[model samples]
Target chain A: MSDSETPQDLKTTPLTSEHEALGARMVPFAGYLMPVQYPSGILTEHTHTRDKAGLFDVSHMGQAWLKGPDHETTCRALEALVPADLISLEPGQQRYTQLLNDEGGIIDDLMVSRSAYPDTEGRLYLVVNASRKAIDFAHLNARLPDSVVVEELPQWALLALQGPRAESALQTIVPGVAELQFMQGAPFEFGGDQIYVTRSGYTGEDGYEIAVRNEMVQDLWRALLAHPDVLPIGLGARDSLRMEAGLSLYGHELDETVSPVEAGLLWSIQKHRRTEGGFPGAERIQREIAEGASRRIAGIKPEGRAPARDGTVIMAGGKEVGVITSGGFGPSAGGPVALGFVPPELAKPGQALELMVRGKPQPAQVIKLPFVAKSFKR
Target chain B: MSDVKYSKEHEWISVDGDIATIGITKHAAEQLGDLVFVELPAIGKTVAPGDETAVVESVKAASEVYAPLSGEVVEVNSVLEGEPGKVNEAPEGDGWFLKLKLSELSELDGLMDAAAYKAFVDEEG
Candidate 1:
């Protein structure tokens, strides 16, 4: 369910009814009937997440597992698709990576975590963007060895509790969660159901993404919301939060035509993978790493009040240089901010540019990303 | 209070002889979610019916508020410059976008009256 697709007959997440009950304004997003904002609105919701805890329903994302005879086999099979050094990813640790095509173009960006569950010891839990789930599943099934099996967990619901107080809030319900560090996942019993939890999230805060069975999700959601610090945040705030955090949205900052290097995601590609490349598009990726990409993702801060929305053209000395991929008012920054691709030379911090917004050139500057400092518990 | 007329684009105009006040309907403001910024037409600018007279931007999108009738802009709600959320808080009062000196009073005849506008809004839903 890409944003461009018609929303008719859209799929609903388990929290859909709850969102409506909270007076959320529902909108079609990523092919799902999702809430874009609640009665508190985007600005308040965004600030709430940064100040306290904001719970988000991210079940619309694709969740699945790749199982093999052992961790090595599973990791090796998965390594064939992504450029990330999954072979060295310790058990219970999560790594972010992109699925690339033969040309080094990103098919989708996903989170790959080695399962810590005893029962699923040889499996890797994977989460991909909702819009590309079907294609990702098919791609994995066709490319992975016959010994490995891909299982889509459509019956599970995913929730994120994120903020500066997220850890303490989650600790109230599951005390064992406090033991986990960032990027670590483990299974814990919550209300008699064993749910998987990761101490990491997309919001650039110290948070957790809990995956629970569909039947148990409602109870968990209610219990989590019962906390004084927890509030239900919608997708509108989610985008603003991630944008302020300077994270990339798959379809916006990345696509089948964009590579990780160009998208400024080279950090996820480990040193071993960079030298001994074996994944899809390894040749092109290696070359780009050596010669540098033509265009690089850069942060944009527009001057004044009116925001420069997505697809707004970037102008340098009266010439078109790039286009904004994602842009909006940064509630925390209290001003308009954006991200887009530009020439590597122009991608430097403090580079001045003009954003053609609503047919008018608005002055902007290229700045270092993560507009707000990350609060991860490193 | 003057007689209020509404355009199909969701703008409202309350005529007082040659001067008229313009704003968006409460329903339109609610539909737009939370407004973050507003850009009003400059005073003394000439506008025709259906002209894009103002821009109301919400967190989710930017929308153009069309002129309900042909007129010359005489005043604007400068208060909105600092607090755009006023449009969401009170769309028909302090949130009024601009005031215009009427150039074509007959354009109001093409717009819907209160009862007709109510029916139109209900039909839209």
Candidate 2:
């Protein structure tokens, strides 16, 4: 499809009717028809997952493969655009990294896994955010060496089983999956189809991401929900989950204007690449690492229940310091939390701050990233 | 049930003498997704027809709940302060948002009946 014609403008997921029947408030998200919330509010869904398990249909995300002669060549080709050192990733290991623009700003965050299974032909597997998939694909195509080939795995549908009980409940369908450690990907047969199962998820919990073929997605979704502990969650809960976990959303925490260093994502950049300085915008990135950027990303905890939505101004000492990137009522915390860029001096863990919501200034406190403690199996 | 009328905004009012018990229709609450908080008008406040009176915030968006008819606010649902999702749980029953003393009963004539309201919802579907 052309870049101008969004898939959301033409496509609906197989679970569209299922969401509608459950009284989900449908919204257009990343070029797909998605449920932002269901009959149970976001707070309820978020809290439920923290205590139980919530199923999310994230099939809109792009799944693709890079198959070629050697792993070194493929990893080197990818490193040209991203700041991560893909060559050091061990077999079955996955790394979370961002694609960068010429200016060293982030294009999108993606998960890249090195396949160890002898049966698999592909050397590297990639999954990127749905909203940035088109541009990312184009960027990869333009930069990859001729020796490497890129193929879009459109046959797959991705589902996330998240929360504390996710592993225990999912084990009912895919036995022996609970043993898979975090940030590891493996192939498993379920519901009569071979699906890619990853021990990682967006929520701050121990969960799995299952990638099933498009034709069998609905069947697999039904099979997982039949476990009695799973509930079909919507985008609303997904947002709150990631926020509490302190994970960055593409448009909110990352954009073409901000580099990875300023966004506090230095861990994703490989140490070798940091010194080698070959990736796009590496020079600027290295400079920012040595001399701190003017603005740095930080978390905000509002005193009241009222949500300080995006674009809310962050103030310190009666002066405008920054703008809120993502803000909402965190169900788990039972109060509003926000992520925004502020001056480096005030970005500490417990600095006092204020947010202007609806012309009223509400007191807040600056905290470190990940407002909600992540329970991911490291 | 003294001739309760509904509006496209999902509000319903049943006249009892000169007073009207106002609440949202079940369909409106369902369409609004999950109700997280409700900002209601103070009792004894007078409001004109079509004036914005209350704010209903779902997890996804915050929407204003306009007054369906001109009236003097007599009572607000204090229970909502503790549990706002009551609007989603029982939109027309215990979830009633407010009660008003009507300034003009004739205003009820301008609204739709239950049958028309159902048809409106069906069309939206």
Go through the candidates in order and give each one's C-alpha lDDT: 0.91, 0.85
- Look at candidate 2 and give me any clashing residue pairs: A8-A31, A246-A370
Chain A TM per prediction: 0.98, 0.95
- The residue ranges of model 2 lying beyond 4 angstroms of the native Cα positions read A1-8, A14-25, A38-41, A119-122, B1-3, B16-21, B42-46, B71-74, B100-106
- Residue by residue across A254-341, what tens digits does model 2's lDDT show? 9998999889899888788899978889988999999988898898898766677789999999999999888876777776778899
Candidate 1 lDDT (Cα, 0 to 1): 0.91
lDDT of 1 by residue, A233-321 (tens): 98888998999899999889999989999999999999999999999899988999999988989999998798888899999999999
Give RMSD (Å) of candidate 1 vs. truth.
Answer: 1.6
The Cα RMSD across the true interface for model 1 is 0.9
In terms of docking quality, model 1 is: medium
| DockQ, all candidates in order | 0.71, 0.43
Q: What tens-digit string does per-residue lDDT give for candidate 1 at B3-118?
A: 88888998888889999999999989988888888988899999997789888888877889888888899999999978999998999898898999998888778989889989
Note the residue pairs that clash in candidate 1. none
C-alpha lDDT (0 to 100) for residue B123 of candidate 2? 96
